[model samples]
Target: MSLTHSVNMNWKLLIGVLAGLLIIGMFSGSSGQQSSSAGQQSQSRALEASNSVEWKKVDFLELELPANIQELRDQVKITSGKAKFFDQEIFYQTGAVPAGVSRSGRTVLLLHGAAFTSQTWIDKVPTLRTLAALGHGVIAIDLPGYGKSSQASVPDNGEFLARLIQSLAGKQPIVVSPSMSGSFIIPMLANPQYRDLISGWVPVAPVSTGLVASFSSQLLTPTLIVVGENDRSLGNRSKEDLKGLPNATLPQVLPGAGHPAYLDQPEMWHKLLHNFIIKVNQANSAQFMEA
Candidate 1:
């Protein structure tokens, strides 16, 4: 084989070895015996191998959320470090934010998008924790089969989601979702039990477009639609889909951004979400909650 071919083969083999070690370390830690130092070392080696890989795309479209054990406990109800909602398996990695104690006490229910696991937040631990510390009561959940919430059910998207919200949402919650999750979110906004319980909605890169059926036809809750520049073509057409709802607002476009702006562009997302929550709280604080 050519020298270059030999080098490539060697690199692939190294990566595979490192990956296997990481997985082994991960499972060993599952017994609550993996030392923090070992986990950090493994993570560092993993990032090094990943960075050495060839460039595939600079404009990645996925947004990653947080993936830490402490965060998991703070936001989720885990058993065997897993949660099953519906028929799908999910790895329940939770966030650090407690349910907020603001007089308004607004809770944020985070929903994952298509084909993504909560592993998205594997690199976003700091930012997520910061938001949690800010008293946002952010509950970022990995849908069924995603994150540590794996080994669960994957029932009908909308109904299963409603149950998840009811179980997780401690009070009047503000749903922050993306892509196809909006189908489930919009319906929850109209369900009587949840309708009176929903305070605000912030949909990022939602797939609520298309002529498909939806509960958008039923909601009257106030919302903020956050869109990334050069986002999905369907999301690009969201203006048409979100049109004419009484409490619906226009999209807040993120510059130099595309889909998954919340995770892909953490600083911007953090700022926008923080400000948006503060605004919603001011407008509907405990004295005048309309929901």
Candidate 2:
């Protein structure tokens, strides 16, 4: 063959190789783009699911009207009810539901300190009415021997609380307890089965039981610890005890308050409870979506 003919043949072979390379590159680029688009779509769906189904807004107007603090205090309709626990009759005071509002799945159990009755919640601060206005079912109970309830010497307060929680709320409900009531709640936290029954916990200046340090590392329940700035002994101890809770919020110190800070700073107390409940609900929704 002549030299020019051989050179032309070589050139043709080089062009063919280049063309194959270009086609491969184009296909790979297209595949990459498609994969990236699919990833973006998946992320968008996750976000939408998290946001769309998360927290729900309450229809305040449809519920009973506690327009002002005074009306909330005076308008509280008290009812007597009995629960049979271990063959013992336990009496409790439950706030009456309004004409149109549904009570199902909206209850918030309030446990007061040893010093006060369930009425302390209604009389001192407008917490019940405020929560009611926000569309929560409020049940402030007087532990046996307090308020209008019958007296009983309970062997295990924790077991009693667990039973109460199951009977009062169809599902897990937000529990708000202050001072001595913390002792009742601490045992539940230590028990895995009982702890899961509670959705969230708000403990205010709870008396320390020395058990918090043992279970704090294992606690999974969402908690908000509120303490009075002035009640150094109990408040500081509570904060230290909660240090091991992985999902717990930093201690919230109420300003210009003492042991019973909720009464001293009613507005701040109400705001904290409202926001914490919303946060817990949102987290629950996100977990449900992931599942």
Candidate 3:
């Protein structure tokens, strides 16, 4: 071959190799940029979840709960306290958020039925410990004239509850009101001033549900009305009355359970409570972001 022809051929090969490398570099740079952008978006979402990047990594639904009640009770550390409101000292048992877990930025208040007290929640069910283990502050309270609390009755149930909730759970607490506590909760639900203080409500066959049943359309607080399938009277009645609330969900019926449903179906009850609390916090976080 002629030298000139050979030189021309080598030049063509060099040009071809250079063109290929340039194309590869363009694609590599684009791919790298896309990866970086995706990472940034993920981080932004983490930050939006209550200012805690750790929350994005943790899924409350996947967290483990102890199968043994005694072991769980032992594993969780709880304390007792009394909050004075309106000349009445309310007795309560509280559990703090567990270690190494990001706080959900929410609290849970457990109120008992007439037959039960604050200890009933700890001994009969896994409400308090499960909530604490899942990174939420939890409190089980003995209403006035019950358990360790003073025998003096509350003059204004709604006002007393409002004070107690603010003093104990802070703003936006998820309240678990079972049986007779419904009288206190229903009144609070009807009052517009206390609406923002409570994040969510679990009315477990509470009494005096009829008071708000007619005006439930105006009550916008997120409510989860739960009852037992076997509890034909109060359970069904409470659901019927409170289900009309604007933001209320359908009655969550626990199968084969009775009036104090959580005692008979603790696992299912805890699962529902966990899911509701997480959803409430998520909604609040979203609202905060939008605002």
Strongest candidate by TM-score = 3
Q: Tens digits of per-residue lDDT for model 1 on 1-291?
A: 899999999999999999999999889877564453554454333233323322122112233333442453355322224444664554444444445423236667777677565555435423345455456555667775455555555656667767666777666577877876766765555443445456667777677545323555445555666788778675576645665444555566777776776655675676666666665565454324322
Each model's lDDT comes to 0.57, 0.71, 0.78
Candidates ranked, most accurate by lDDT first: 3, 2, 1
Worst lDDT 10-window in candidate 2: 54-63
| TM-score on alpha carbons, each prediction | 0.61, 0.71, 0.75
Model 3: runs farther than 4 Å from truth? 1-73
lDDT-wise, the better of 1 and 3 is 3
Write one digit per residue (lDDT tens) for candidate 2, span 31-59.
98887576355434333433433222322
Q: What lDDT tens digits, residue by residue, belong to model 3 across residues 1-291?
A: 999999999999999999999999999999988875764454343234433223223333453354544454456788998888888788899886655666777889899888989999788887788888777888999998788884758888998898888888877788999999988887876665565568778999999988986556556556777899999999988988887665666678899999999888888888778777776686677757775
Model 3 TM-score on a 0 to 1 scale: 0.75
Cα deviation at 76, candidate 2, in Å, is: 6.0
RMSD of 2: 14.6
State which candidate has the highest lDDT: 3
As a TM-score, model 1 comes out at: 0.61
